[model samples]
Target chain A: MLYREAGQFKTSYAADQAIFPLAQDRIGMAIILAVAFIAIPAVANEYWLQTIMIPFLILSLAALGLNVLTGYAGQLSLGTGGFMAVGAFAAYKFATAFPEMNIIVVFLISGLISAAVGIVFGVPSLRIKGFYLAVATLAAQFFLLWLLVKYPWFYNYDPSGVISAPPIDIFGFAIDTAVSKYMLTLIIVSVLALATKNLVRSHIGRGWMAIRDMDIAAEIIGFRPLTTKLSAFAVSSFLVGVAGAMYAFLYLGSVEAAAFDITTSFNILFMVIVGGLGSVLGSFIGAAFILTLPIFLDNFPRMLGFEISVETVTHLQFMIFGALIIFFLIVEPHGLARLWTITKEKLRAWPFPY
Target chain B: MAFFLEVLTGGLLTGVLYSLVALGFVLIFKASGVFNFAQGAMVLFAALFFVGFIDLGVPVVLSAILTIAVMILLAYLIERLVLSHLVNQEAISLFMATIGISYFLDGFGQTIWGSDIRRLDIGLPQDAFVFGASVLGDDIFVNELDVVAAVVAGALVAVLAVFFSKTKIGRALRAVADDHQAAMSVGIPLRSIWMIVWAVAGIVGLVAGIMWGAKLGVQFSLSLVALKALPVLILGGFTSVPGAIVGGLMIGAGEKLAEVYLGPVIGGAIEDWFAYMLAMIFLLFRPQGLFGEKIIERI
Candidate 1:
């Protein structure tokens, strides 16, 4: 009965269209935000903030970006890593060149640069479709990585080819500690996630869904394929780029172009797939699941009192990861988000099946 | 001119080996409509199995036969476990499933066979055969192993061509590829066709594994050749056998030429992305590729 929405009537169009129409949902979200913003920061140690929460939020942002393009627009791209590299490099250049600029502005500009590159790569999607388009995106991945690596100027002629993030000073306040960095990432991710939720609920998102379902029919219905698809790319790349900037500046502190390789792209894609396509909450859930899996695998054997070799554990990690992907796809192809929805539905109908 | 000829010959030889890998991809795609991203992993697995058996004191011939049996078994397991369950799923899901398979094979293969790079010696000559040394007072050489690879690839292609044309099972495979419902209605067993195709693809992977393993030691990175084969598929068309061979040759020669002639100006190492760029540009003009059938969409 706690989950029932029986008396929540929509008195107006605004109320009907509210993101959380139910009182229970609003309360649920408030509790979650309260936990993330207050409780965790107060109780959790530096290790949890640094190792788990920070990276999880950054990668969740990346997965959300991919979800917008591949999940929402039905455009499968393998070029996410390249776009992320663009963001990281651009942020580095901006932060160093103009030290006075606000750090958040620097990330936005980096995201904009990534959006431009994404539009350029996304041009082929108009003509090519399906797996063919996916392969075409690989051109963007390989070419962008090569371009960054080949030009020493991109890294400011660093000898090691790895670029370090400049210090984060927002209005003369230092964001050096793990908690500060975690807070910074949380605010940005939460804001962006809220904005993305609104964007997808709007007409543009409807256009993307229409195109994804059937491009020909979508075209016949007067949805301009060019703008709809390209806009999706721009928005998706923007989110991903900001995430990449955070990944470099806050999480890793220093990174090379090689850090955003194809494997990274695949990991984010896995997050999108496992989390749930086209769902904002799914992105976060997926990122957490994928990120924690290896850690769980590593520690589980030790907890059982079996001393497994590191190499064997790493191999087992790969095998189990692969097997789980298949298992998830077969059992629940829609992903963990669908399972969550099912649970909520059951809760609403608890103790009475008929 | 002599140096150019040497580079061209070397690239062409490498292209032939690439075609060997791409051929396996074509076999599965044509028969089962699943883009087997795991083909490269399958290659590495076969090579690892072959070498692992030899390390166990089995003779070379016996090891080869054992690897073939294992590949066939792999084909059956993949069909029964993965493909059968995903009968009418979207193409993207199937592709992702293959990626999962690729990861499993990579970890499982390395786990069983050990991750150390082992040299594969099936007695192929490793000498450079020089050509026209006296005519121009300059030497142009080619790897003898590469020549053997070309000959072996040619023989395999010829056998496949005849088998496809003459065998009853081959016709069933084509039928299944053409229209699954029609083929099944006509009593052609869809499951067996998929298994046979996968097994045949596995055998092709074995041939490619042996050739590549002998050239470069059998190791984890051997699976990365799948990335190279992708551009070949894009150029030649995913569904065409002849397209795979022709596309492989063009990419091989094109990348080598760009690397040797254009590398210095661009700080070298352009080979990594050259084939993909070429294919991407080519796709702009012909999305269906030169040999692929035209795609017609219906609303």
Candidate 2:
């Protein structure tokens, strides 16, 4: 009854084409945003803000980036971690070189750097398709990591090859606290995520979806394959790069090139796939699921009063997480977004067998 | 000159092991069209099981046989639990599923066999074979393990070639690879063929695991070697057995030469990404791989 949109009426094309066309969806989204912006910030402790919310947001952004290409554009990339490394390293360089510049500017420049790298790697998509293309991306993943590690210049010649984000200030407001960092991440993520929604709704997004569905058909229909594919790569990598900067600057603070390894790439791809490929909200859901699962797993045994070693917990987490990935794929390859929609449908038809 | 020979020989031998792993990938991909990302995990699992069995006091030969049996059981389990349920899905979906399988196998292998890097001394010598100094005024050398690995890889390729051409099941697998619907139409049980293919791939992974594990120690990196096989697969065609062989040798040799000659200039450690970079550049000119057929897309 609560989810029913039967009485909802749209008088104009703009109204009908609105992101949340249904009144119920609009209300639901408003409530979620309210809680996220107000309730959580007011109540969530430092640990939750720094450890959980910040990571969830950053990873969701990364997942959104991957979703753009792999989910929306049908380009299966394994170079996400490498691109992220580019972003992180670029940001590090920017922040150190121009210490007086705005942190926001640093993030944007880094993202652009990553976008350039992404396009270079994406050039292979013109020549290669499917599995062959996927393998080509692996070169990006490895080569970038090697570049970051081999060159000490990226890390500001730190003897340990590890770099830390310098203190960032916006208009004399030092964003060093967990709450401030969380707020910064939230603002960046929301603005970019909104832009993503708009982008996906535009003809460009349709072009990507067309390519995803059938590149040959998309090409026949007057879309340039190189431009469409590279644009997807550029936009996706830009978001991922920003997320990488946030991950290093806001979340981890101190990090090394090793932080963004092949595992990180696989993890982001999993988030995109498990979150739902083409759904915007699915990115957040998938990120939250993958990121939080490990923490929950680590704490569950102890909370139940059983003393378990950290090693055992980690091992169990991998096994369970792996099984869960398989389970989700088999049960609903469309991911949690599809499940959410299904539940909404059920809610609308409540108290009926159908 | 002798030093050049040593580096070349080393690369060739290392390339053989890479080919063995790539062979596992080619077999499954050829038969089922699933890009089994779990191939690396299978290598790790097989090595772990073999070593775990031996750790429990089983003889090496018996442990090897039992490990093979376990891999066969794994093949059956995967086909039943994962593959059968996922039939007729998109190639990307199938690929993602295999990645799921990879994660599971990685965790399961380590959980059962312990995650510590373990040494397997199957009495293989570790010393290098040296050519006498009188011939070239310097000793030419080859690692014994590399020599053994190369010989084993050669034999495995020969045996697989014979099996694919001569065996009935192999012919059926080839049929399935050619066209799934046509094979099914002819009453060839697709499930059985998949199982056989996976089992054979599992065995190939096992051999790769043993040789690599012996060289690097049975550790997580053994799984990463599987990633190295991807460039080899690209260089050699993913479906061509001979392609994997030559691709592996070229990659192994190319990376080594680059490392020895280009490493100092680049500050070293080019081995990690050299093969992938080569494959990426090569793909621009030849996307179907050196041997893979050029696919013509139809709307």
Candidate 3:
């Protein structure tokens, strides 16, 4: 019933151009914000906030970052987790070295660093496409991970070969509590998601779509392939970097090289493919759906009162996960985002054959 | 000099093992364009299943039969369930599907066996033959198992060569690989050909798995081993049978030799990136791969 946009038509061009053009969509989004900011902190327990939701959100952001490049821009990247590692390590170093810089600033700077790396890697995409390009991106993943492992300076020469974030304070408010950390992440993710939504609707985003549609035609039409692709790399990496910082600071707290391995890259890639390739909101839904399903399934065997080993659970999870991906690709190859859109459409026309 | 010889010999042994695994990937890619990233995982699973069956008191001959049966079943499953559905999808979609399969197989293998690395003693002799002043034990040797592995890999490659040239099923598979629609119109059962190819690929994986599991133990290590095959595919064309064998050996031996000789000079364990680095060089010059068919660029 609330899905109806009838009789609430936009009067101005600006109103029509707004992202949530429908009045109900705006209100619905506001309600979601209220629940997330107000109700979630009140209801969610510490472990839920710290372990599951926060990590999911940060990963959602990273997946979103990757989806823009791979899904929207038609570049396949298997190096997101590596870029995230760079962000995490960069944030760790920034915080540790300065000890005076604000944590928020540290986070922003990590994204900038990742953006630079993204541009460097994006150089290859101007030359390669499809499988060859993916292999090149895979090279980046291995190379970056190797660097993080070997270059002692990245870890500040810590013999542990891992980096840990010290407790951070945002605006003199200590973000040590699970609630506070969750709030911080929620705020930043909201702002970035909003920004990404706006960015994708803008002229530059159009340029990206143009390139995705046909790079040669885009070039003939005067879209600079180099600049457009590089900027995509930059923007995409920056967001991914911020996500990594959060992953290190909020979720993992301390991580070894294993956290950002090739599998992690694949996880982010799967999230995008499974979530709904080019859609921003689909990234979050995909992350939530994919990330939560296994845990839910892992618990299902036990919750239903079956005594299953964790290893078995892990195995079953993989099989189910694999099947789900294939199933999704088969049923709605566009991803969970497309599925959501269809659902919303159905909801809008509920009880009406039209 | 002795150490060099020993390293070289060891490298060749490992190289042969890698070629065996890479051969499966090459074969699948040849028959169908799908790169079986799950080859190593298939190896691990097959090996695990073989040993697990034997541990259950299945006779040696029966265990081997059951394992091959399992692989053949797996091949049919992929064809019926995954590939046929993805026949019209893009390369990236197919690649993504394979990634999903890889994860599923790895997880499935671990769950069944409970993640413990099972010791596989297939009643094969564990004695070593010595070369020169240094002794190379049979367990690690170019001994009975390794010799068997080498001969088996070579024979399969040869058999595939003959099968492709002489057999109807082989021709059907080739026809489908060349153009699915064309093959279908001519009455070649596309689905059956895919099943045959995947089944054959699965058997190839089983052979490789037995050797690798014997060496590494049947654990999650299969996925990592599979990663090595990517570089092999890069060196040999994706569709080349002999190319896979040759490429796998070059990588296997090349990585080991590099690690042994060049490790101390430039940190260590160059094996991780050696194949990739080599693959990248090949990609730059011969993007279709060493034995890959020629490409015509079009919009």
Query: Which number leads on DockQ?
Result: 2
User: Candidate 2 lDDT, tens digit per residue, B132-239?
Assistant: 544468788889999999889999999999999999987998999999999999999999999999999999999999999889999988988889999999999888
Let me know the DockQ for model 2. Answer: 0.76
Per-residue accuracy of model 2 over A1-354 as CA lDDT, tens digit each:
677877788899999889999888899999998999999899999999999999999999999999999889999999999998899989989998999999999999999999999999999998888899889999999999999888788887799767777989998999999999999999999999999999999999999999999998999998899999999999999999999998999999975788899999999988888889898999999999999988998888888999866666676777888888988889988889999989988888886738
TM-score of 3: 0.92
Root-mean-square deviation per candidate: 1.4, 1.6, 3.1
| lDDT of candidate 3 at residue A48, scale 0 to 100 | 89
What TM-score does prediction 1 earn? Answer: 0.98
DockQ of every candidate = 0.75, 0.76, 0.47
By summed lDDT, the worst window of 10 consecutive residues in model 2 chain A runs over A308-317
Report residue B169 deviation for candidate 1 (angstroms).
0.9
**Candidate 2 lDDT:** 0.91
lDDT of 3 by residue, A1-354 (tens): 668677887789999899988877888899999999999999999978886889889989999999889877888887887898888888888999998798889999999998898888777677666665676677677877777787688888888666567888877888888999899899889899999989989988988889888888888899899999998899999999999888998888885667888888888988898888889988998889878887788778887899976667778888898888888877777788898789788878877937
| Model 2 regions more than 4 Å off | A348-354, B131-137
State how far residue A118 of model 1 sits from its true place (Å).
0.4
For A1-354, candidate 1 gives per-residue lDDT tens digits of 789788889999999999999899999999999999999889889999998999999999999999999999999988899899999989998898899999999999999999999999988888887777888888998999999899988888889777778889898999999889999999999999999999999999999999999999999999999999999999999999999889999999985888899999989999998888889999999999999998898899999999977888887888898898888878877878989999989988887846
